[model samples]
Target: MIASDARLAINPNDKVLPSFSHMADAIVRMATKPDRRSGDLLLWSDTFASLRRLFIGVGAGALVGLMVGLNTAIFPGLRAMSRSFLTFLSIIPPLTLLPILFIAFGVGETAKVMLIFIGTVFVISRDLHLYVLQLPKEQITKALTLGASDLAVTYRIVLPQIMPRLIETTRLTLGGAWLFLIAAEMISATEGLGYRIGLVRRYLAMDVIIPYVLWITLLGFLLDWLLRLAVARLYPWYRTGKE
Candidate 1:
């Protein structure tokens, strides 16, 4: 009977080990396997696409900066009037112009692009004007002494020296352009990250909304990174501050 009891106890102990082993196996599987759906992957890809758009926005910002920079450098007298007018316009919340833009340019690409352009130009121009005025007179004088024409002096001497500062100014203006785009899209956009966010919000889809916000943030960051890289490449000498 004692031997029978010993065998029965052993049988129960054997079953307990397998049970523990199965539990351990389940825990390991849970730890190693990722719980992601196909939707997650699609979301990631869409985020990347949005990031590309943000980079495009940065390019737009750069163009706007270039135009404003050229205007301020070439025509200092007009700077004040342009600056004041643009400042007034910018202060009027970007969304407020939606109706006007929609009426004039319609709820199309033109209006959206114009909104970004208008939002960025004045501030960038103001920064560029200040930087131009602060440039060393000796550089301008040297260019003139070397038989450089007015246009040549402005392009070769003035522009090259301030190119780094102009890039920095563009970087700053990008934020404003981004803000304007989001507002403009929210006002009247059929497609875009901003539009997607607005749609999700209307439905109270917090999950989708959160991911879209992450997408926008990540895209903005990537654009800023690309701009910095471009600046480093285009103005390598400027990095040392010896230029």
Candidate 2:
């Protein structure tokens, strides 16, 4: 019933654009009101699915990037071997891989998640590798002098020092992650913020599209703010720019 109402609200050949009130009303109805068929209130289920995708992409990408970066920085032999490959992967535009990814992973959740992961990992890894490399050699030397194992020093000494920087990098890459996510969902998805926008676009549902865009922006801002707060609260010793 809600979908039919929405369909009536938008006609494919209709040149009439919806007014701001109409758009706002549509957005409110879709978000707060219920559908006769689904019985589930609002689009919260879709929102949750999108949120899961976002957190998974960011968490996994950050973890892989940090591990690869640390390994590259700490192991000279591994660094020399993997440097060229890293550069190669970094230069290849992630979008160009969409076709290959869809082909390999299918038009499913895995493909979408992989898109976000691949989009972010290289930049994050490179930034972290450079950050680690920039650490003062004296610190490593001091740790060695204390009879600390290289593994112990890298984990206990180096990781803590760079956590703030890693958080900053994660914040920076979020935009690209969103871009990749939206593109993937637009190409192939049943439900996501991007999927909803794409689905509604067929009937020129500017109302839904606009609200979805604002929601995505709001979500990104909140995530970035949370990361900043975590840095301040969890790692009080690391001074951010405002400090």
Best by the lDDT measure? 2
RMSD of each: 12.9, 5.0
Model 1 Cα lDDT, one tens digit per residue, 54-95: 456556755676666666565557665676765565476665
Query: For each candidate, how many residue pairs have backbone atoms clashing (under 3 Å)?
Result: 0, 0
lDDT of 2 by residue, 1-243 (tens): 355456557773332355566678877887888868776544575677788887798889899999898889888887898788788888888888999999999998888888888988888888888888999999999999989998998899889888888898999999988898888888898778888888889978777777778888998999999999998899887784566
User: lDDT of all the models against the reference?
Assistant: 0.64, 0.83
Q: What is the lDDT of residue 76 in candidate 2?
A: 88
After superposition, the stretches of candidate 2 with alpha carbons farther than 4 Å from their true spots are 1-17, 240-243
- True-structure lDDT of candidate 1: 0.64
Error of 2 at 12 (Å): 16
Cα error of candidate 2 at position 212, Å: 1.0
